[model samples]
Target: MTLATKITLVRLALIPLYAWLATRYGSSVSAGQPDEPFRLAAMAVFLTAGLSDALDGWIARRFNQHSALGRVLDPLADKFLMLTALIVLCVSPWSAQHKVPFWFAGLVVLRDVLSSLAAWAIWHRHGRVRISPHWTGKVATVLQLLALGWVMLQLHFPPSWIVMPAAGLFTFASGMCYIAEGWRQFHHGPPPP
Candidate 1:
């Protein structure tokens, strides 16, 4: 495996770690326990994981180490971490106030799920459809990472009001774009090789 893919796998490995820290700390905070230390640890882990995502992508491109596995695993890790964080923050003692709002999280998850289904259907029909990542999807991802970080700050509430909804909108729009593009691909066949 390429170093790039290895880095991406490390991110997948961190998902369980992120979940454990978020849940352990989140439950404590919800129970009204003093857990700033734990909260800070969660934040550190989140930021590190988030930053590492960018780093790995850059490494893959810079060194021409791209692989099919990297393409699949990188997005999987990202979506898993995002969905996990949103659900954990929204439901748990981690939130200072209700956050990652239900609609926001739902819309985000729905977009991802629907997009995945569309891709799978297209692939099942055509085989080896390389649906390039959409630009809007990247925008949605950045906004989500920002929102996740903002929520983790735990010193803020109002910004989430702005960020999560916008992220949801972008996510939804991107999903539509993917669906349309995938449909076009299936109907028209993959673009000129």
Candidate 2:
């Protein structure tokens, strides 16, 4: 395995850690335990994991170590972490009672699921599918990270009506962007190899 792969794996490994922290503090905060430490800790884990996501990609490309495995694992890890955070934020004791709409989470996961299926279909047809990460997708990801971070923090801080909608809007917009890209790929066909 390449060093990039190893780093990617490490990032994936951190998902459980992030989940545990979020769940632990989320429950406490939801229960009205008046504890800030767990919430803070969960936030820290989230930021750390997000940083690792960026680092692994940089390392992989900077060292010319990109691989098929890295391509697959990197996106998979991102989806998992993002989804896990959202689910924890929505379901934790605090969020369970005052949760972001379940449809927001549904939108996020459904988009990815549909995109994955499209990509697979293209690949299965022996089409040359170059998985060049799009700039819009990256921007969408940053928005997602920020929105989720804000939502998690709101669990302990002043709850904002804007955060949830902002998250849903950006997530939905991102999904639309991916859907358009997929359509382009389908109609125009993958660029000549």
Candidate 3:
């Protein structure tokens, strides 16, 4: 495996640690005793994973280490990380005071589910699916990550009131864009290479 893919694997490995720390912290907070150390550790792990995402991508491009495995694993790691973080922070009682809004999380989940289903359906019918990442989707991802960090770090300065809804809008917009792309591909065919 390439060094970039190895880095991506490390990011995936960190997810479980982040989850454990976050869960422990949440449990402590629910018990009316917040665990600051666990919370900080979770944040550190999360930030490391997030930064490694960028680092790996840069390495793949800069060092010419791109591979089919990297393409697949990178997005899989991102989805797993985001979904895990969203569920843990939003559903946990510890984050009752400052959690990602349920609606926003729902939007993100719904978008991804629908996108995956659409791709599958198209591939099943046409034997292939052409999925080009849209700019809006990229923006939504960055916004979602920022929102996650804001919540995880317990940043109350600007508040979730400002963060989540903005993320939701982009999430919705990107979902629509993907839906339209899927519809076109389904009816016509995968675009030419």
Candidate 4:
């Protein structure tokens, strides 16, 4: 019900719009087709969603509007957006050289699936727990989003290969960090109060 949560909800709403724009109108500006209104609109929607990810988080933290719902929905929105973008990038021919490599996308997808299951199991058993994400997890997500946006916007200055591998590595590392943290929490209980 807070403003931060409202912003998060807006982001959740944008997910399908982003996906629809990306898949329904995805195309390559680098491929020189010219006259790409759909592609342009898709990029705009994607960029807006990407920026809103950070904005909503800042709103929650800066305004002290964090809630249990915010904690839950924030990560859910993030994962959904990332999953949708990855799949669309892999499937669409939207870029000359920035399309996601399947291996990288696959690793990210696999990590997310496992993490979701682990989190769900923990939640079901423990009830309403809010685990802080690792720094590496945050980095991984930023890298992934930057990569996706770069590909979406058709910017090649940083290039996909450099960004994608780093994204994958950070994502895997964060997953491992979460596993270790989960082990500690499940066995040891929430670290001191």
Which candidate ranks first by lDDT, i.e. highest?
3
Residue pairs in clash, model 2: 30-94
TM-score of every model versus the real structure? 0.89, 0.82, 0.96, 0.83
Write the residue-wise lDDT of candidate 1 on 1-193 in tens digits: 9998888888888777877887888888777785787778878777777878888999999999999899889888888888989888777646556356778778888888887787788778888576688899989988887777777776465566687778887888898898889889888777865
lDDT of 3 by residue, 1-193 (tens): 9999999999999999999999999899889899899999999999999999999999999999999999999999999899989988877735675787789889999999999999999999999998899999999999998998888877887777889988999999999999999999999999887
Compute the lDDT of residue 23 as modeled in candidate 2: 82
RMSD of each: 1.9, 2.9, 1.1, 2.8
For model 2 the TM-score comes to 0.82
- In angstroms, the error of model 3 at 90 is 0.9
Off by over 4 Å in 3: none
Model 2 C-alpha lDDT per residue in residues 1-193, reported as the tens digit of each score: 8887887788788889888887888677656674678777777877877788888888888999899899889888888989888777667744543454677777777878888888877676656665566666776677667668666666444444665566667767777876777777777777776
Best model per TM-score: 3
Error of 3 at 100 (Å): 1.5
How many pairs in model 4 have backbone atoms within 3 A of each other, for residues 3 or more apart or on separate chains, i.e. clashes? 0
lDDT of 2 at 186: 74
Residue pairs with backbone atoms closer than 3 Å in model 1 (clashes): none
lDDT of 1 at 181: 90
Name model 4 segments beyond 4 Å from true.
27-35, 61-63, 127-130
The 10-residue segment with the lowest total lDDT in model 2: 92-101
